[model samples]
Target: MSKLQIESALEILLQSLQSNSVMSKTFFWNYLKVFCKEGFLVDLQTLSIALVEKQAVFLIDSIACLDYKAAQQLDILVLS
Candidate 1:
């Protein structure tokens, strides 16, 4: 795979996936296979709830699929 494709895959995972739930190892490993055809790997051992929240925050800031009013409501809920 090209560098662009690898970067695109990682961006999608880091920006688009949900955060308010469990992340199966299989899910990540599957995507890893698609982008990393060689020796690359994800450091699963370093994952934590904080990491999930950080990713969620990134997803929220991107505002890719949210309705404006709904996004506002969610922001309120998150702050609350």
Candidate 2:
């Protein structure tokens, strides 16, 4: 996908997350895993910063549910 398309998709996902709607933890983590496996670095970075800035407790809790591999991938993305 083009960079613009990736960014747009991430924006939409972020909007959904910020909407205060209830999202299942399993589903949310799975969505994030997809993004990580697809190597959506920019999107992940944007998402990480947004979640941190917003102090998203949901995000923090979800991190604890991640498997080792997914957590490692996310750690790399966040630390890079």
Candidate 3:
């Protein structure tokens, strides 16, 4: 994806997360997989803040689906 596309997608994902959508949690998990594969760097602090703000179980479950390496790189283990 182009940089603009990634940024747009991130915005959408963050909105979905903020709304506490269960399907968006799955989308976030899948997007994270793509980020890991494509070597994209997400803003961990922003994402963490969104997750914490929602306090959703589906969000936590999505974090559980992340692989160790990706989780470590994203520093998202704290969310799980």
Candidate 4:
């Protein structure tokens, strides 16, 4: 895909994510990190694809933006 096409697709995804009800927006991102750490690449990709189908979204927390609230642990999801 061209640069513009990729940007457009990401823009659509970002807009869709903005509309979803986020239960701790970082939930899925933290889950992704843990999954990758534990070597669940295939499982994570499969489940993420399924969630994207429903427009589910996760906003990752960055260390540079750390604050009192950010210090609190985010909700982590464990998939069996």
Candidate 5:
């Protein structure tokens, strides 16, 4: 799509997100982050498709381990 059209669609999505009745802030916040991180925000169609895909959710603290032992601890928590 043209730049103008893409901008318009994003504006509409933003408006919908801003509406209290239609959007969940937590869900949208996570979704927006993932979309930007995965480079899925360039086209509206891709965003629409990605939104429906399976998503992984885990506690931020649970995934914080950097060393092998720490990772094992996190992995145990995840498995348990």
Candidate 6:
């Protein structure tokens, strides 16, 4: 990816990390994959790598899906 794309991905990832809620591994991983492919996330593997490369405390730093607003903001995406 170009530098700009990579930067954008990083920005998106950081934003997501800060604002998006943590999802189940299966759900979050799948969502992240698409975002990465779409150039919305840089170093997509960072999620999984964070699991193994870092300690449990590190992985525990993740947010919960309940905290994610993006899903709720989209009427079609929200189930309820």
Q: Give the Cα lDDT of each candidate.
A: 0.41, 0.52, 0.52, 0.36, 0.40, 0.39
Candidate 2's error at 59, in angstroms? 9.4
Better of 1 and 3 by TM-score: 3
Q: Which stretches of candidate 4 lie over 4 Å from their true place?
A: 21-80
Decide which is better by lDDT, 1 or 3.
3
Q: Write the per-residue lDDT of candidate 1 for residues 1-80, one digit (tens) a residue.
A: 34444345556566434454456444644554443344222322122122244454343342324234434544554555
Greater lDDT among 2 and 5 belongs to 2
lDDT of 6 by residue, 5-80 (tens): 5444434544455555555345545655565356432333343333333322222223223223332232222212
Q: Which residue ranges in model 2 land beyond 4 Å of their true spot? A: 24-27, 42-80
User: Number of backbone collisions per candidate, in order?
Assistant: 0, 0, 0, 0, 0, 3
Q: Give the better candidate number (5 or 6) by lDDT.
A: 5
Pairs of residues clashing in candidate 4: none
The model with the greatest lDDT is 2
**Stretches > 4 Å off in candidate 1:** 16-18, 23-26, 38-80
lDDT of 4 at 40: 31
| Number of clashing residue pairs, candidate 2 | 0
Looking at candidate 2, the ten consecutive residues that score lowest on lDDT are 55-64
Local error of candidate 1 at 2, Å? 2.4
Query: If ranked by lDDT, best first, what sequence of candidates would result?
Result: 2, 3, 1, 5, 6, 4
Choose 1 or 6, whichever is better by lDDT.
1
lDDT tens digits by residue: candidate 2, 5-80:
5555455445566656466444545676675466654345555555555545244334446445544555665556
Flag clash pairs in model 1.
none
* 1 versus 2: better lDDT goes to: 2
Clashes of 5: 0
**lDDT tens digits, residue span 1-80, model 4:** 23343334434445544555575345534543443344333333343343344444242133114322321222122122
TM-score of each: 0.30, 0.39, 0.40, 0.27, 0.29, 0.32
